[model samples]
Target chain A: MKLSIIGVGLIGGSIALKLKEKKIVDFVCGIDNSQDNLNEALALNIIDEKADLEDGIKNSDVIIIAIPVDATRKILPKVLDLMSDSQTVMDVGSTKAGIVESVKNHARRSRFVAFHPMWGTENNGPKSAIAESFSGKAGVICNREESAQDAIKMVETIVESLDMHTIFMNAEAHDLHTAYISHISHITSYALANTVLEKEKEEDTIFQLASSGFSSTVRLAKSHPEMWVPIFKQNKENVLDVLNEHISQLKKFKSALEKENFEYLGELIENANKIRGILDK
Target chain B: MKLSIIGVGLIGGSIALKLKEKKIVDFVCGIDNSQDNLNEALALNIIDEKADLEDGIKNSDVIIIAIPVDATRKILPKVLDLMSDSQTVMDVGSTKAGIVESVKNHARRSRFVAFHPMWGTENNGPKSAIAESFSGKAGVICNREESAQDAIKMVETIVESLDMHTIFMNAEAHDLHTAYISHISHITSYALANTVLEKEKEEDTIFQLASSGFSSTVRLAKSHPEMWVPIFKQNKENVLDVLNEHISQLKKFKSALEKENFEYLGELIENANKIRGILDK
Candidate 1:
């Protein structure tokens, strides 16, 4: 099988490397807006060749879109229009509702599958790609019923070859679930980094005194704005709802501290500890 | 030298285990209000024997207080009252200002050293103790001038033996700095965990969709409330100030998303990304 990957950055490059390692694809062609990334992907051997989107889709049996959500919304319909009837197309963006809605009425809608691989690092670019990055992580297929059975099966086979657990959900539920679990974490981290950077003017002290906990909490702050801004924009309502809840929770802590209510504070912490049962398992 | 640990929990037990592993002290004694903790410490060989507070202080050349910050405030002066002229008393509490001020007027003030080791995990109890916990973390000795030269030197030697870097600061500075870097992270995490818990009703979905990023951001929510409540209470003013700043930062993101200010949101994320330079170093 031949695979064509668009926007060959961290997620795209990683999938390419893993599929090549597993021998699931005999050839992988790259389509990227940045020539430097294409050059890096080639030098790093992530793809067999760099081709135009039209040529890449025509030549490949499957096409995977791995760009930012806003770009995927803009590019998904165009790829579907250029695809042959038998070729399968999938996207691995963070948010799904907007992209899925954008192509809901395309003539070749049956050939498209919306997917999100639930794995990433703070680092980005082709250089950060690893062959085992997606293994053991969830891969969600949204609106799977809308796609052709053959297209859905092909994407499932790809997900399995990458060693990811597969789950199926509609686009709306997928967007909401990710907003609660994934998107809010980035917002919390970014705000935390800004809070420390704003209040602690002494950069040297923060560097010296930061513990493993602080480092881990703030690690997601390093994620690229170019990639995340589109996500927050596309998933604005869901992100906003969760953000309001998060702020309300912070205010409760502030009120308890102001009133010297250590007992109440302890109760809040104990309640939060319940997450251990869900996350640590 | 002889060593006595007042509370045989995670911090105390870890210190005891490390000290005993290095043979830095001739004998180590354990003192705790809970008999089960004492028994566990003995079974784990974290202490040479279990003793009453009076006997532990009298028999040991150095007594270490490793309890919650509020308890440290109540127990610090009493421990100083029982100390001999040549003996040293120290604490490993998270907050320093309140603990230091509590014993400022004691007759044995010079015998007491206010220390805060900048290391921890979500786990607790004697069984959670490990020998290498404090290595390479900062150990801050607050109000070093108040302690006798010999007492400060003794604690410094122990710190060095544990392979930790030592920094000296006043109690007020220590409390404020910790509120900004360490304390706020825990509050953010607990609030984040609760926010998700309240909003996402589907536990199975949350369990499946939680990425490594989400897990890392919320890991501190698992910390024991018995350990953190006192720190938040003792450093209430500083914690409030940082909490207000953190809330303000979150509000900015919300307003940006509400107004469709993608440019402003991008700018905020870019600013937050600056933390990578400090934390990754």
Candidate 2:
């Protein structure tokens, strides 16, 4: 089998590496616009070969769009236009509703499947790819019925090769749940990073006093802006709804402190501790 | 050498385990208020024997007070009263200002060294203790001048045995810097957890869709309230100040989203990305 991957960054490079290792795909043709990324992916043996976008798509059995959500939205329709009826295409985009909507009325719409792999790190670029990163994570496929059975099965096979369990949800529901589960985390981490940067002038002190807890909370602050801005733009309303709730929740903590309500503060923490039940699940 | 640990929880149990492994302390006496914790510590080999507080202090060469900050503040003076002139005492309290002030006028003030080790996880209790957890972490000795030379040497030896480097700071600076770096992160984690729990009613969806980034950002929400409420109560002013700054920082991202300022949003994330420099240091 042959797979053509678009945008050879962390997610794309990782998928190619894993599929090749599992012998699911005999060849992986990396189709990235950046010459540096292509060179890095090739040198690291993350892909069997680097090919031009048009040639890569025409020769492969499947095509994976692993670019940023904004770029994916703009390029999905064009890719679908280029693919033959026998070929299958799937996107590993973070926001699904927009991508699914962009190719909704296309003649080749059924050839494409909307998929999101629930795994990531703060780092990016081809060099940051890890084959083991997605082993225990979720791979959500949205608007499953809109795609042809063959396309859905191909994506499911790819997800299984990556060692993730499959989840089915409509495009709208995927966006809503991701807003609460994923998008808001990046915003909080970025703000927490900026808070310490703005208020704490003694950089040496911060470097010395930082604990493991602080590092974990702000780890996502290092994520690329190019990737996140488009996600926030595409999922603006849902993200805003959650962000407002998050701010209000923080205010509850603030009010508790201001009133010197220790008991109330303890209650808030105890409520938060309930996350253990969900996280440990 | 012999050591007495007043509270056989995460920090104290960890300290005893490391000191014994390094052969710096041949015997350890546990003095936790809860019989369950003492039993668990003994079963896990965290402490050699359980002893009464007064008897334990008189027999040991050094004493470690590792309870909640509020409890430490109340018990510090009494512990100093029991110690002989040659014996030394140190605390692994999260907040230092209150603990230092509690024994300021005591006749044995110089025997108490105010210390805090910069390491922790969401889990607590002796069962969560890991001796290697302290390696490569910072151990801050606050108000070094207030401690006697012999007392300082004894605490410094303990830090070395834990395989951590020592950082010296005054009590006021430790509280202030920790508010910016450590204390505020917990509040944010607790708040983030509450935000998700309140808004995302579908527990299964959250369990299925949660990315590593969300889990990382909210990991500290699982910390026990018995430990945190006292830390907040002791360092209320500093925590409140940093919390206000953090809320304002989050508002910047909200305003950018509300105004549809993608350029400004990118700028905010790019600024947050600067944290990589400090974290990687």
Candidate 3:
């Protein structure tokens, strides 16, 4: 199958590479507004060719929107307008609700599949793409009933070929669960990084004394603002809910520490260790 | 040189393995309160032999205390009392201020070097020890002036042999830096894990939609409470201070989302990305 992936950055480039590695796509074309990104993607062989939106959508059997959520909302409908009944379109954005809402009543809505591959790293751009980025990860196909069966099956087959498990959820449930499990993680990491940067004046000391725990906890702080800002905006209510709870939890930790309540702190950590069961699954 | 490491668990067992791999110590002995840990260390060939603490101290030229901070504080005096001028003693615990204060005026204080290697995973015990655990990591040598120059040199040589860098800091400075960089990371992770567990009811969704970002952010929540509780108690003030700032930062993120201030949220993330510079250093 021929595929045209927009954005042509990390997730887009990675999908292109994986599809070609699995021999699932005959040709993978890409479109990016940034000339540098387009050049980098082509130079890295992440895309077989580059084309304009009109030509790309008209020619490819599949069109994948892999840009930031804000851009996805703006560009998704345009692609849907040109899509044929035989062509399938899917989005790999982190947030699903806003994008789905925008295209819900479109004439070609049946051709559009809303998806979120539950995988990413802090880095971005074409160079950040890796061969095993999505292997062993889960892919969420939101509001599957909204898409035609053929479009759903094609997207599922592609995700399955990448060795990823596929799960179906409505847009609301997907956004809520993501805010709890995924979006809050980035917020915590960013705030944790800012806290350290604020309190720890000696940058040299941080570089010298940083342990693996610190690195792991602050890893997501390196994520791109352009990518995450739209996500927080799109899933505002759920993200706000989790962020409030996270702050409350930190305040309790602070109070416990101030009171020297080692027993309480220990209990909190023990309870937190229950995440191991879910993670180990 | 003959070396004996007390507590033959993750940190101690891994040190033994690396020392043996590098052929730096002629004979390595291990002593642990848990028979299972000692047996695992022996089966893994992480040590050349196993012995009681008294026997190990009496026979070895160098001794390493690699237990929990509370255990280290309790056992350090006994180790110091048994040490001769020719023997060197060191510790690999997370907190340094309390341990340093405990042995401040000891007669053999000059013979003891307080060190903490900035490396570890969420797993613990002998079974969790890996051969390459400390390679390319930093080893903090706290209050080196309290240690005899020869002893400090010997410890530094061992750290260097393991392909790790040695950094110097006073005990108080070590505790404060660790609270900011290491201890706080664990607490934030534990609190984040707890927050998700409390808010999200769909356990299966969490397991399926969890991304690498979530895994990295929550990784330290899996750390053993037995290992971390004392560290938090020992560095109570610094941890509490950083924890307060962290909570405030999260609150700022929440308010930005609640107010639909995308500009502020974007700036917050962009500022947080400054951590990438320190991390890359």
Q: Each candidate's lDDT (Cα)?
A: 0.93, 0.94, 0.90
Residue B217, candidate 1: alpha-carbon lDDT: 95
Worst 10 residues of 3 chain A by lDDT: A247-256
The DockQ score of candidate 3 comes to 0.86
Cα deviation in Å at residue B10, candidate 2?
0.8
Error of 2 at A11 (Å): 0.2
Question: What DockQ does every candidate get?
Answer: 0.85, 0.91, 0.86
Pairs clashing within candidate 1:
none
lDDT of 1 by residue, A72-110 (tens): 999999999998889999999999999999988999999
- TM-score of chain A taken by itself, candidate 1: 0.99
A130: Cα error in model 1, Å: 2.0
Q: Mind giving the per-residue lDDT tens digits that candidate 1 earns over B72-112?
A: 99999889888889999999998998898998889889999
**DockQ score of candidate 1?**
0.85
Give the top-scoring candidate (TM-score). 2
The runs of at least 3 residues in candidate 2 whose Cα sits more than 4 Å from the true structure, single-residue gaps closed, are none
The DockQ-based CAPRI class assigned to model 1 is: high
Q: How do the residues A215-267 of candidate 3 rate in per-residue lDDT, one tens digit apiece? A: 98999999999999999999999998888888788777787788888889889
lDDT measured at residue B3 in model 3 versus the true structure, 0 to 100: 93
Residue A217 alpha-carbon offset, candidate 2, angstroms: 0.3
